[model samples]
Target: MTQVKLANNQWGYISAVIDEASNEVVSLNVSNHANKQQLATTLSNLQATIPKESMPILHSDQGWQY
Candidate 1:
């Protein structure tokens, strides 16, 4: 996760799930803070839209938000 600065200097974080094969964004969640809950929300949204049997392997780095 990374911080995004707005026009007013407010910072927010965005977690997004992308379909690498399709090069498309499948899900997105934005919050003022980057944390486990934010990541969970993004993943939950993605799960709701994708089929369980076709679920892709999720990957993450060493970031705490991941």
Candidate 2:
């Protein structure tokens, strides 16, 4: 997760999922809040791109959103 400052001093949060083997971004989400919903949406987006039979290992910093 990363935080970015927008114009007028607003903030945006970025959430992303990467494929380790391919070194590619599999999923991404940006929002004003970095909460559970944001994480959920990121994972949900990733789910749509992967094969149903593939069980990919997910690694996180174990932050609150994880």
Candidate 3:
């Protein structure tokens, strides 16, 4: 897992992935003003990108999003 800061303030996210099996990218793009509608797409993006058989243990710091 890895993290990248968003240009927007108070609005942040952490990206995680199955690194060993594949360089999958799981980006949790979040915002302080995010709502339920936004959440679905964000989660969907992560789910869609992850490799189905790649179960690499997700790792990350104690990020506010993670």
Candidate 4:
């Protein structure tokens, strides 16, 4: 997860799940706040986007949202 600064001093958090082997972005999500619930929601969105049979292992740093 990373913090992004937008125009007018607005800020948000960007969380993404990437395929390490292919170096492709599998899923991404943004939120104004960083929290566990937000991470769960983002992960849920990823799961909905990919097929269940091809679900990949998820890995993350020790961020609070992770």
Candidate 5:
């Protein structure tokens, strides 16, 4: 895991998607101000990256960021 800081302060939540099956990263995203739009766009992009025929899944921490 990595952290992004700004002006000597830790910023907002960062999220990513990892493939459970192979332990490979499927997608990654970061936001200084995490919101619904950002989450939605990230999720949409993750979905797009996954093969349509593959039943890939996304796992995230149970935080307000989701």
Candidate 6:
């Protein structure tokens, strides 16, 4: 998770999921607030791309968002 300064000097939050083995980005979401909805959307997007049979493990820093 990270924050960026938008053009109007407002803040935007970014949430991303990366494929550890390939160093590829699986899903990414940006929002004005770093909340559950943003994280949920990121995971939802990843769910669509991954195969149903594959059960992937998620590792995070255990931050509040996670």
lDDT of each: 0.84, 0.92, 0.50, 0.81, 0.69, 0.92
Superior candidate under TM-score, 2 versus 6: 6
What TM-score fits each model? 0.84, 0.88, 0.38, 0.78, 0.68, 0.90
Give the candidates in order of lDDT, highest first. Answer: 6, 2, 1, 4, 5, 3
Scored by lDDT, the top model is 6
Better structure of 3 and 4 per TM-score = 4
Worst 10 residues of 1 by lDDT: 55-64
Off by over 4 Å in 2: none
> Candidate 1: lDDT of 41?
93
Residue-by-residue lDDT tens digits, candidate 3, 1-66: 133456664444333333444565455554444345445566577677768996645455644443
Model 1 C-alpha lDDT per residue in residues 1-66, reported as the tens digit of each score: 768898889999888878878989999988998888998899889999898689488877737766
Query: RMSD of each candidate?
Result: 1.5, 1.3, 5.1, 1.8, 2.8, 1.2
Model 5 clash pairs?
none
Give the Cα error of residue 24 in candidate 3, in Å: 7.8
Top model number, TM-score: 6
Per-residue lDDT of candidate 4, residues 1-66 (tens digit) = 889898869889888888799898877888898888778887888888887678577777848667
- What TM-score would you give candidate 2 relative to the actual structure? 0.88
What lDDT does candidate 5 reach at residue 23?
83
| Model 4 TM-score relative to the real fold | 0.78
What's the true lDDT of residue 55 in model 2? 88
Clashing pairs in 1: none
